[model samples]
Target: MEKNKEVSANNKVDVDSRRDFLTKTPIPELIIKLSIPTIISMLVTALYNMADTYFVGKISTQATASVGLVFSVMAIIQALGFFCGHGSGNFIARMLGAGKVKEANEMASTGFCMAMIFGIVIAVVGNIFINPLASAIGATKTSMADTKAYMSIILIGAPFMMCQFVINNQLRFQGRAVYAMVGLMCGAVFNVGLDPLLILVFDMGVRGAAIATITGQFMSFLVLLFISLRGQTIKVNIKNVRLNGFYLKEITNGGAPSLFRQGLAAAATLLLNKYAGKYGNDAAIAGMSITTRVMMMLGSAVIGFGQGYQPVCSYNYGAKLKDRVREGYFFCVKYGTIFLVFAGAICFIFAPDIIWAFRKDEEVVAVGKVALRFQACVLPCMATTVITNMMLQSMGKGIKASITSSARSGIFFIPLILILPRVFGIRGVEVTQTIADILAMGIAIPFAVSELRKMKKME
Candidate 1:
């Protein structure tokens, strides 16, 4: 009994210490501390994603296009994961900040449960219509077999993948990013190790790649589940599942931006594939696909860095420490833009070499080279665009956040892709995302400025 009491007291002290650390830490130090792990997590995740493209790139351009085509499905899975994770995680951070631990637990459990159910449903329904889905995602006859094989295996792991993402996000929002990073890194390391063995030695081809990816996801799910079950942060319990309108409403408000952003990413990818398929061929599709993945991999660091600001923003805003939120936002935008500018310059200078590193097809490299440089030119715009969207979402301004998030892929890209191809031919395909980035930045600027001004008033 005495030992248990001492343990309980120690836990209380730890919690108090964390609360003080989050509320009182200097802005630059706090953001950096939170960001490093999150950045590593993001980079590892991106690297594993690139691993599929890299290894598959060696098989054939057709096979690479098949991987690219199936990426739309992967994006949808990620969409749902981020929606549930960010929605609940944001609410949990605020609840914790306000000392509403019970509500935080309820949100965590409900969101996780919902993701699991939805993942299972998507997996079943997706596999049922696998052929049709493959065609819809722009799989040509040559790539059809590989696309279906890869996508089917990926769908089977949806529940694990989505749930793992939820747990990771919850940990990050709860100021446990290092734990989240470890879970993600372990899975990534496993995935990388399995990729070459499965694809080359075992000779499973794209199916091997799919199996490797899912295997890593399942491992991550187990790791994160163990962590959550230990009751270190908010424990995800079935008893706390509140699948009611109130929780759903909050989740929607907080997660809608992510849903819109990721869902539109899926849609935009499909459209881009279709347009590329129509204008050129499998090589065009392959080139654009490589461009998308590489750009996303490069952009991950900025997104991860922005995420570091999220818990700080939500926690302090909940605690009514508006000054910290404002300061963190300003600091992130300044540094994020600087970092992206340098990253973009490197990509722009080595566009051909980068594209060649993925797939050596002359046509693929030619198409991808121009696209990479064009997008990289405007890539710094994303620092502002993403930071603004994240800030709004973390602060519970869902409508504003959703609108800003939608602008990049939905409101902007869709129209540009449709019209530009008609006028400029294939060059339209290369530049669609660039125009979208500029427009997204234009939209985000006002929202970020407006919110920062409001935060200042509150301070």
Candidate 2:
């Protein structure tokens, strides 16, 4: 039954064009074509995130810190979604490249179903232990009330947000990034619009911001599912779920890097907030949180560009086209690095103004200005580090990919966030990410060189 769908003339034409487009297009042209939509998606994602921070910042210093505290919880949720989505999407991309469409189709549904199930579990469990969870993530007495209110609502929407990420990622891995972009755009626009309305006009404050976030997630989930069904892309059907050991193992091999990367991000954020609060209190946490979000906005472009290269790498590697994979990697790294150098300079210059835009507290500005500038100094290094992880992950080099991915937020960040503060106080927290970033470069370059050299030998 599924095979019949692919045999239809329109479907066959669609499939053939997509294959040619991924494998035969000029390398630069291909990356740009894919990068544009994914870039837009990432920027829009970053913007709505800023919108939340911007609107909520109006409430109080405690409110802002509370939202920052909730961020770690959200990261854990995203880690699980990416774990399933990437795990399944990675296999889907390679399988399609090797012309195993049925296997790709099965993996899609299996990954989607797995994400939704996990989402439900989070929703159930998170709301049950909201207070203790909030405390564990670094919420202090001043911010506990706002944190619980925002967190409970976000926890309720976990299923929708998780499914949205799963479907969006699956589309990108299938070389349908434009479809993913549109769905994500609609949700982002809606979230941005809803922010002021819910937060200020309605006087909902932190609660309003949380509601807008989850509703926007549900909106994205609906649109992405519609796009998946209406288009000629792989259909995500319940019957296609293969929950056995074989598919589960494949998902882990493909997605473990993402899990480690994002899971470590959650752990790191918890520690950052805890240490900042311990030394400096709510204002320090607020300032550091703003810096974190600002850096995320600046870095989204490189992540978007690297995402563009992932499909090219995975597809060609699966098709045994080593030259194309190598070409795309060099092209991405060269351009990505150049872009970041300029972004870092600009961000470094206007660090104080950027922090003030989020929250006008003097303490917040003092902490954020230093934090943002310190990170900006090392921003250029991230292009190589991020792309290497993406490349290794795309090619199913799980162990190597996980190591590089873990470097930025885990191996280095966890240790730095812990030891630095003991010695330098709040200054230690400000400089930790920049230090971790530079060290991560050391890990990424060697791994990338090793893989590229092996491919050269094969050639």
Candidate 3:
């Protein structure tokens, strides 16, 4: 028993040593290994979203759409979460690259603390303004009750959601993507398991779905905290958690692009729901919700790849290996484009089936099918924006990254959603997102190409 225990301890030390070496490994290999876990983690995330739609859809179209209606609020919370997570993660990655372990630890601790505080604020504010907020996001009278119930639970759990993000991103920066994946996947699995039990068996409806989701998020948080304590090299010392103005500024600056992107996504969803509501009933809102969720799932793999590439780009840039950074960028774009093309093809081919997965209402299916097909057709191009913005942010080009991040949902899509729907009606609604995606890609090409050329010039 003593000898067996000795071997176990030694093996554990070896694994830790290997993980520690990962941060300093060859950038390409590190990214590939890191990204595979992230990809799986993201897929698990997508699965829960699908589960949400599926379970909610089983209740009623209104119930499913209510999930969609309140999606904007979720987006807002995610925006804040990403702002803190990405901001601190970027700083952590660079600091690790530069061997500033102490600084990295401080950023991690402070970022987690800040996210918790902000999440509490959002939870309070969200609950206080639940009715008005739901209305603002295009919840009709029919959908309003369901939306309120769902949003309330989500808001109540905002701190856990936000803190989970903080822990996940920080772990990734420490080159522990697998650990991060474990936490995410565990929560997702639990959520998926609970959805049916809560919604169907317990007959809890929309509130049940929300409860299940919150429970999953809390589990994820617990797992993430355990991983941080047990496996991570950097320790978050609460005593050392004083906010360094400069570090805070750096984190926020680095993470601002994510905030812009996610924040604008919330705005776009709200506007889309509102516009759709003006035309028809809750069905329209529901249809748009299902369509977007489908697109998001299909897009997850690409997003995962981009996320995988981010740490590589940041680490290489910090190490001043400009060539490696450029190489990783191009590799990610190529891989992302290919993956999106395949995903888009699948979405386009099965648009109806995909919509039906959420709800079987003929009208919702018809509307969602058209929207899904159109969005899928533009998927490849749309992926460019994700890669370009991620690369820019990873390299610490905050301004350019923010612009790229905002272009898709904020700069172009929001206005087009408003104008095109006015001119063309529901048809405009179907086409608006596609047009926005194409234009965003068009704009992204020049930026990505120009940036790459600049890297060559440096060479």
Tell me the lDDT of model 3 at 66. Answer: 90
lDDT pick, better of 1 and 2:
1
What lDDT does each candidate get? 0.92, 0.90, 0.84
The residue ranges of model 1 lying beyond 4 angstroms of the native Cα positions read 1-12
lDDT of each residue in 1-459, candidate 3, tens digit only: 999888657645643454355445776677788789888877877776678888999999889889988778888887888898899999988887776666777888888888999999999998999888887877777888998999999999999988898888888766678888999998998899999999999999999899989898899999998887674356566765757788789878988999999999999988888887787567777888899888888777888888888877777778777787787777788878888899889989988898887788988988889999999889998668998999889888899899999988999998898899889888888888898888888778888888888888887
**For every model in order, what is the number of clashing pairs?**
0, 0, 0
Candidate 1 worst ten-residue window by lDDT: 7-16
112-192, model 2: which lDDT tens digit per residue?
A: 999989999999999999888999999999999999999999999888888888888889988999999999999988898
- Sorting all predicted structures by lDDT, with the top scorer first, yields 1, 2, 3
- Better-scoring candidate (TM-score), 1 or 3: 1
**Ten consecutive residues with minimal summed lDDT in candidate 3?**
14-23
Pitting candidate 2 against candidate 3, the one with the higher lDDT is 2
Error of 2 at 459 (Å): 1.8
Error of 1 at 71 (Å): 0.8
